[model samples]
Target: MSSFLKVLFRNVLNGPSTDPFPLGETFTPDRLRGKVLIDPELCMGCGTCKEVCTAGAIDLSELADGSGFRITVWQNSCCLCASCRHYCPTGAASLIPDWHAAHPEEDKYVRIEQQTVKYEPCSNCGTLMRPIPAKLARKLYASSPELDPEQLRHLCPACRRLRDALKGRPFPVAAAKVPAEAQA
Candidate 1:
């Protein structure tokens, strides 16, 4: 009909309906997140990023020696949600415009970043552990003024639990006291 002809005429006047294939360059859209970047110096292995990651792509590993921690991102599994970047208290994570690493298999696209910081040894048993990040420690102290920052900061969670459970108990628990026998 007349309408169809008019559309055809417009299309004919407009030339090609699609851009040239493959070789034609295209602009990357604004806020296009392609990969995740972590600055090891700023990251404190807080696990905040891991908790917020929707795709479960972020992994945190505490080194056995307790001297530092490792953060790994499985780029192949990442959805580029930027939740990690948003939740990172230290601004350690950010989304980069560059594409993620290309690999033949999902397993091959792993990216690992490591950070080195001395472990806070348990004041009671001397067991070493990665301490809570500085920013988180500050927040914890701010929220509860009654807390002894020194006591809480140095002791591992297990030790803290044990200390809390034994407080004011009559029985002389093995862990509660540094035995006089050993002291001598």
Candidate 2:
């Protein structure tokens, strides 16, 4: 009984231990998985996110014109599993700490994230394709000074392999204008 009274007095003096959220500022941690987001610049259109999503919240599709691809995430269906963020090779999928997902019935279907990534024509063959993201390209070929990393990002897979085969020889046809230093 004495120890119980001591704890009660300590609790009374310390006040409430719970955060006053909804009425005041609260603590949001860095690792909290709240909302799903996709970065268009970094997405590879690989459909890995859609595959890993257990709740079937992610949808990936080719555009009608076939120029590019579209990705969508139905916020209502997402289970906050963070599977997409884990399996994504490009690190485009992210779970931001914005836990305000409440919505009315009418707006439930409308609460979606949609993004379209267009394909740029390959510098070599003019074939429409998605170029490797510049950030990824730099990291991949960062060690090679002889290789023009900027030009390499613009080429299609076939042209990229062809460039590799050339082995520092003069390119058969200009994929894109080489910089002055690269030409030298």
Candidate 3:
């Protein structure tokens, strides 16, 4: 009985052990890994976040803005490993406190979403894509400088592949045959 009374007194004097956050700001430890924030303007959409996320929490989806893409962070799958934050090249991803992240539904987790910038249309199909026109052209023609940049316009992967298929121009399969006399 004495021990029980002591416990009761301690509980009353110490107050509730639960943290009051959101409504009342709560303290966060220095090492605590919190929610993530992504800045669309700074993000290059290089897929570095998706690549480094071990939990597969990051999803980059196609948006209406030409080359612009949408980033979806699945808080449910996120382990708060900070891998995505560290790998982000543009300093677009960062950790922030989400004290009120709790939800009644167990499946629902906190999410940070944004969309990247839209670039000009592709020359071939006139489809808007990534803002870097020169880079996109280089990706399409790495070795061949003969391919015209005006012809390489901004095209999504699907459209680019379709165009390539319709061209029906077979890519070089092997080196040109050397003359038999040259072999000697």
| Candidate 2 per-residue C-alpha lDDT over 6-114 given as tens digits, one digit per residue, 9 for 90 to 100 | 9999999999998998899999899898999999999999999999999999999999999999999999899999999999999999999998888889897898889
Better of 1 and 3 by lDDT: 1
Name the regions of candidate 3 deviating beyond 4 angstroms.
Answer: 1-25, 64-67, 106-116, 120-184
Question: All candidates' TM-scores?
Answer: 0.53, 0.87, 0.50
RMSD of each: 7.8, 5.8, 12.5
The parts of candidate 2 lying over 4 Å away from their true place are 173-184
Compare candidates 2 and 3 on lDDT and give the better one: 2
Query: Cα miss at 37, model 3 (Å)?
Result: 0.9
Best candidate, TM-score-wise?
2
Where is model 1 more than 4 Å wrong at Cα? Answer: 1-15, 100-102, 106-184
lDDT of 3 by residue, 52-171 (tens): 999998998767634567788877678889898898866778877664566667536534454555555544444445533454456657777866554554444444565566574642
Regarding TM-score, does 2 or 3 come out ahead?
2
**TM-score, candidate number 3:** 0.50
Clashes of 2: 0
